[model samples]
Target: MRYHFLSLVQIFLLTVTTPVWAAEQIVLNYKVFRESLSVEEISRFAQTGELSSSLKINFALARQNPKAVRQYLTQPVKVNPVFLDRVLNTPLGNVILDQISQVIHTPSQKADRQALRAALVLSARQDSQITLIEIFKNYPTSEVEVDGDRLESAYRQLRRLQTNIENLMGV
Candidate 1:
């Protein structure tokens, strides 16, 4: 009886400690080429500005600047989670989310819209700010796939959305 109680307690503790879901790998898809990178590698680069060997090689193959990638990963766009949530629920926000989802989505391409919405809201709720890395980290999936060629376009879309939102708020 005592052993059964201890086993139950251990099970509860493990459940509480584990993350329900989070992106473990990022698959960058460019044309017909695809490369996978671990979330830890990206997060470390964002925090320390140091790229792993695999990342460096991938950047070279993709013709992407590590510095620029790091910049976007770390740049924080301040937002109010409540307001963000409201906007994201609107028609216009749905359009924007749909566009962004094309660039960043699940490996199976299922629930892309919903996953993007959750990632955006959770990222903002974490620090009242959203960064590309934060969104990637919060994505509720085991693997997140990105259209590497359309990455710049996606970033532009996000910036445009943020600007419009701020203008409307008179901020």
Candidate 2:
């Protein structure tokens, strides 16, 4: 009986903890990608006449030569709530999709939030949706409906994309 009880306890713990761990990893990936990108052009133009910052300037110079911008966009930067109900079910899903899309897009690529949101809405995979929903839950909010049916959709293409970013972060 004791052995059976221990086994049951272990199974319960694993089942409970697995979701939390998975949720945390998804959130981390979302954060790494979000922090890596910024609206620097707006800030730079506000501060200086140049539309781009020194980073962009350097990137251009490097492009003239041959080096990756990974060194610039990614840096040794040291890195929420419980709204994990239904992310896209509410209006917040649209916001979440846009942010993830922005992360997926090339830094220099000209894309608007709406376009990114639309793309992800159309092509996002399961894991990507799960990751986005996990990231969205950390946001503060009011009463929101949870829609399990819709979030089931997946941006399978993003499966590799998220993995690649997490791998890049070495996290």
Please give, for residues 45-140, the per-residue lDDT of candidate 1 as tens digits: 999999899888788888889888788778887877777788888898899899999999998888898889888888887778888888889888
Which pairs of residues clash in candidate 1, taking residues 3 or more apart in a chain or in different chains? none
Query: Number of clashing residue pairs in every model?
Result: 0, 7
Question: TM-scores across all candidates?
Answer: 0.84, 0.20
lDDT of 2 by residue, 9-86 (tens): 898755433332111111111211211212333223323434345445433443321122221112111110112223
Clashes of 1: 0
Q: Which portions of model 1 miss their true places by more than 4 Å?
A: 1-19
Displacement of residue 19 (Cα, Å) in model 2 is 5.6
The positional error of residue 133 in candidate 1, measured at the CA in angstroms, is 0.4
What stretches of model 2 exceed 4 Å from their correct place? 1-13, 19-80, 84-88, 102-171
